[model samples]
Target: MRAIAYFKQNDIHFSSDLPEPRIGADDEVLIDVSWCGVCGTDLHEYLDGPIFMPKDGETNPLSGKQLPQPLGHEFSGVVAEVGPKVTKVKVGDHVVVEASLGCLDTHRWPKTRLSCTQDKPCGACRKGFTNCCEHNGFTGLGVVGGAFAEKVVAGERHCIKVSPDLPLDVAALVEPLSVSWHALRSAGFQKGMTACILGAGPIGLTTIAALKGAGAKKIVVSELAQIRRDFAQSIGAEVFDPTAHGTNAAEVLKKMSGDDDGFDFAFDCSGVKATFDMGLAFTTFHGVCVNVAIWGHKPVDYYPMLVTCKEKILTGSIGYTTLDFESVVNALQNGDIPLDDCKKLISGKYTLEDGWEKGFMQLMHHKDKCIKILLTPNNHGELKSAK
Candidate 1:
């Protein structure tokens, strides 16, 4: 099998001899990948990592699987086979994988080194919050080999079938879109409510679409990059260049709100001190602010009065749950989310062999020029139109 995988820190490449993944349990599924999108986390791993990936010579605590594994958590594919107990979907079904692996999945790897016991799982998982599991990890990140190859296997619980009419390329986006959707859901977003997103990166752009689908009456995006602002506008966000506003930018953002007071919800996807403070500073008195970005280890300055005096809800959201995947799929199916807009997110496509240089490095160097770049196994015929 051919694959683009990560070995140790700063080492990821293509190989033709990577072993094919097999169904390890009776409820596992075998997927023939159609397309896989490289994520910022993938780039982070290549630059400075082993973050989610197990250390060299060490296996993942959840899967007990060693490194040098395939790297792709955002993917869509067709079901090629199903285990004896797999009842979610059968052969030939078009599907997207949920990709999350947590304490609840320890049953699939009885030999794993995690502390999950037969009767007790993580505290978060016990309360139905697998996304916040104590030992949470993702399939492609290190839990197991993922969809960046000819075929990958997962448990039936992680597979969600999509409409045959949905394009496979857009389907691969469900994973990332679900991340934003979950954040919105956590914020208690409602139709006709307004939102202010503090960034225009991949997650920020998807947050725009998620807000629109939830029936937002007005959405504003603040970004410093011209190209990213353009991308946000292409999908219906009212763009703002904070760099132009100087220190008075936060005041200007509040004036643009529907009430001219502040936004009903603000999401800090930029994860910087300035944006983080601005998110709280400009939100309406009782509005919510959700931190959705993967921030660094250093702590940022915070004023207790910013959130305390206003009685605003300050929270954060991580990975998506299975329900998020199902809801996003339904939204795309019912046209609440335009498939054409999803297609616009795709900036390029390449076969798996060339993915590292063309797809990964393209994101590494020329990130502003791209939104999402897809890679394929060439098993499907999308390569004929590859750019």
Candidate 2:
């Protein structure tokens, strides 16, 4: 089986003859991947090396898997085979795999308490939100193999059935959209409130769609990139180009709405320090500010005083839980969010054979022009150009 593997930190070495994934247990299902979305975390690993991923000699205590793991996770595919115990889904069913592996610690909630390797019952799992389980480990980020290849083996608990009406190519977007669902849920967005989203990247754009579906009174998107700004506008968001305006972003939003009254809620998806600050600066007093971005380095001036003074609720949201996935899938089915436009977020595409330096490098260097770039694997010795 052909797949993209990380031979070392920051190096993407493709192997055309990698061994195909095999089912390790009766609860697992083997999937033939149709499309996999290239995530920003993947690009970060390509340039900055492994940070979120497990290091050498480190293992996921639950799955007992080692490091230098497989890459792609945002994926959609069909059931190639299923273990005898996997009776919920049948062979040849189209499905999207939840790439997350949780800690299974419901009481530990969001923290990864399972790092201690204890035998405690997770609190989050006890509440039926096992996706945030601190006792279990992530599948794609922690496991050795993920959906980056021709075939991937995921536990049956992670598989979600998709209607045939959803195109296979577009189904790969469900995972990322699920993240947007989780963000809104964590922020507690309401129908009559206004929201200002920082950074109009893929996640930010998806959040706009989610907010619209949830009936947000007004949705404003701040983006420096013109292309992304245009896309946000096309999707009914009041788009603002911070760079072009030359005014303070927070001030601009207040002025446009005719008051110093800040935004009801602000979300940061860019992970940049500037955006995080903007999210805080623009939020209305007693409002909520959610940091949806994943960061490596600590940014300067995180404004603890402002949060205290304004009595604002500041929080951070990680990946999606199972409920988030259900919400996203339902929104897609109801046409609350346009799946057709979600496919347009694909800024670039590559085959697995494109190699690391070329395929992954294109994503890293071309941020302005790229949104969600994907790498398709040519299984069964089928090789074709991806121009």
Q: Quantify all predictions' global Cα lDDT against the true fold.
A: 0.90, 0.73
**Pick by TM-score: which candidate is best?**
1
**RMSD score of candidate 2 (Å):** 4.2
Each candidate: RMSD: 1.4, 4.2
Tens-digit lDDT track of model 1 for 66-184 = 97899999999999999999888999999999988888788889669977853689788888888998888998999999878989998898899999899899999999999999999
lDDT of 2 by residue, 243-340 (tens): 76554656887555333777888888887877877777778788898988877676556758989999999988878776777677778888887876
lDDT of 2 at 114: 47
Candidate 1: global Cα-lDDT? Answer: 0.90
